[model samples]
Target: MPEIKTLAGNLTFTECPRWRGGRWWFSDFYTHAIYSMKFDGSDLQKEVDVPSKPSGLGWLPDGRLIFVSMKDRKVMVRATDGTVSVHADVSAYVAGNPNDMVVGSDGVAYLGNFGFDLEGGEPFSTTNLLRIAPDGTVTVAAEGLHFPNGSVITPDGTLLVDETLGNRVSAFDITPTGLGPRRDWAVFGQPPKTMHDDVFAPDGCGLDAEGALWIADARRGRVCRVKEGGEILETIEPGTGVFACMLGGEDGRDLIMCCAPDFIEHKRIAAKEAELRVVRVTVPHSGLP
Candidate 1:
């Protein structure tokens, strides 16, 4: 059995756990804040606060941090002195709020959207992925996605995007020009007629050195380690709300999770309780943020 441990708690909805510079960086969704802490929970610091909600996180090779300012449909770059500036204005292409993002090795960032006004109780819809180059150029990477959420880039430069409402994970080959084509990397459940029928609602994801994906299944309350074509290798139950996860630690085998009682914005904000939990795994992390 994998032994799970709590690193921090009493947060306001944590998502996007990232391992960088020997620390864990994440975002508190409703609180509109970004944070970083040591693996043992020391030296905790609030990095930045977005006026709008924040979710996915990425970093350029030069050490600049970029986070998805969900409501504004923009990715903000943070300088060393704490100056946050708009790196990409994606409003022209995105109809809904941006969600998870991954920074490619080529300094390109791929972002996703919620595809519907969930907070406003709007019906679900399909959205596409946006590619933001280092030069701030934005273009469509993939389309017709059912709420693309967590994503990661493999050592070979393949992009894996988890479609939360679509019950599948999509794959793409990223190049200097743009993405090549879309393929089904993993299919956990059947094609749901509607988003409401999704079973393994894959959320945030992380890649392991062994080419396996550790995905957070929100509706099922577990972190599932799956291989190509949707083979379930293992499952880690957190017994709470698991929104996102990452692999990082001294040896890079630490599997961390963002845990709370629920994902509803009202409940998370009102409850004011979330935690970062970790477990030791055999496979060290591999791939881009």
Candidate 2:
């Protein structure tokens, strides 16, 4: 077993972890803030606050910070001068609040959404992943995804998306116009019909140097190191509800796990019980955040 340790606590649901500019950066959902810290958990800093609640985070080529504003169904951009602006409004194409996002090196972003009223206990439904160009033009990159959550683009230009309710990681070829044909990168089991069903619910994830993915198994309260074709190479039970995992650090072997008691909106907002945890791994991180 790999030794796990607490990096920081007193958070209310952390997500969208990325290792960039020599720090571990993440968003605390209920707190509505994004934070960053050093390898040993020192120098913790609250980078910014998003009143609509922030989720996934990435950087544009020009150094602007772009992130998901979940409740407002928009993508926000923070410039070097700390000015925040709406990068894109995707409410017209989405059925529910937008969630995770991964911006490619070329400055194009692929975004995901819940597909239903998750906290309100609505039934599950498929959704689309929207592609936002550098000019902020929004288009449906792909459709029929069951709760497309965390996403990453492989070095070879393949986009891998975690379908939380679909029990699989879907892949698509990155093309000039948009995405190409869809394929299954990894399948856990049959897609769960309801939220209460036995499910893995892959949330935020990170890619490793060997091309495998470290996926946060949301409903299972664990993190899984999975290979292509649905093979589980390893598992790490963080002893809490692990919502997101990212491989990053000085050498990119630090697996940062976001832990919380639960994901209920009200419950998380009521207390600061969430934590950021970490464990060391062999492979360095690879691909887009």
Candidate 3:
């Protein structure tokens, strides 16, 4: 177990954290706002107000911030001067709202969607993984995902996407144009839970220097480290409802986690009032951006 910290007190549904420009940037889905702060949780700044409920945050090769606009199922880009624009409109491809994302070294942004209205009283299996080019072109990378969530590209450029409702993480080779053949990188249902998210249940994720996948197990309240061959190496039990995680801190070796132990009950009463919390653990490898 690691020591947890309140990066910002009682955030209204926070998810998707990324490190950029020597700061930690994240989003509050209900608040529809993006924020940044120092490593010590100081100098918090409201970077932008994205009305579509921003979730994931990424960066372009040229230093522009790219984020997922969930309600619209689109990817948006924020320039250095803070201008936001639609990078890709993926409504036609993704079955539901976009959730989490990861940017590749080739400058392409890989995004996932909610698949169904998890909190809107209607649940259906319809989600897809999408890719957005540097020039704002949108294309369907993979389809039929139950609820695609967090994702990351390997150092060799292979793309890994966590199919939340599917209970498995899938891998695909990234080409100059789009994704290649899909393969199961990891699956998580041997030990089943009655109240698990219908999909994979894995949410926010990142890549380790040793090519391992660090997944935030939302329903299980733990961070699982999965080997490339789909083996569970280690698990960090937060003992609370975990939402997301990112490798940050001074050396990028500190694992920063976003948790809300009361999210399940909170969502039932009001989907917008979910709390935000974070924790840190010292690890061996720094994470991918």
Candidates' C-alpha lDDT: 0.90, 0.92, 0.75
Question: Which residue pairs show collisions in model 2?
Answer: none
Ranking by lDDT: 2, 1, 3
User: In model 2, where do residues sit more than 4 Å from their true spots?
Assistant: none
Model 3 pairs whose backbones collide? 164-199, 164-200, 164-201, 165-198, 165-199, 165-200, 166-199, 166-200, 167-200
Residue 129, model 2: Cα distance from true site in angstroms? 0.6
Return the TM-score for each candidate structure.
0.97, 0.98, 0.88
TM-score of candidate 3 versus the correct structure, residues matched by position: 0.88
Model 3 per-residue lDDT tens digits across residues 91-153: 887666778888876688888877766767564665677778899888788877767788877
Q: Which ten residues in a row are the worst by lDDT in model 2?
A: 191-200
Residue-level lDDT for 111 in candidate 1: 93
> What RMSD does model 3 have?
3.0
Misplaced by over 4 Å in model 1 are: none
Candidate 1 per-residue lDDT, tens place, 1-289, comes to: 7789999987989999999888999999877899999998889999999889888888887888999998888999999998999999898888689989999766799999988787888888898899999978999988899999999999998999999999999999878788888999999788777768897999999999999999999887899999999999999998888989999989999999999888887888787789999999999999977
RMSD, each candidate, Å? 1.0, 1.0, 3.0
* TM-score preference between candidates 1 and 3, better one: 1
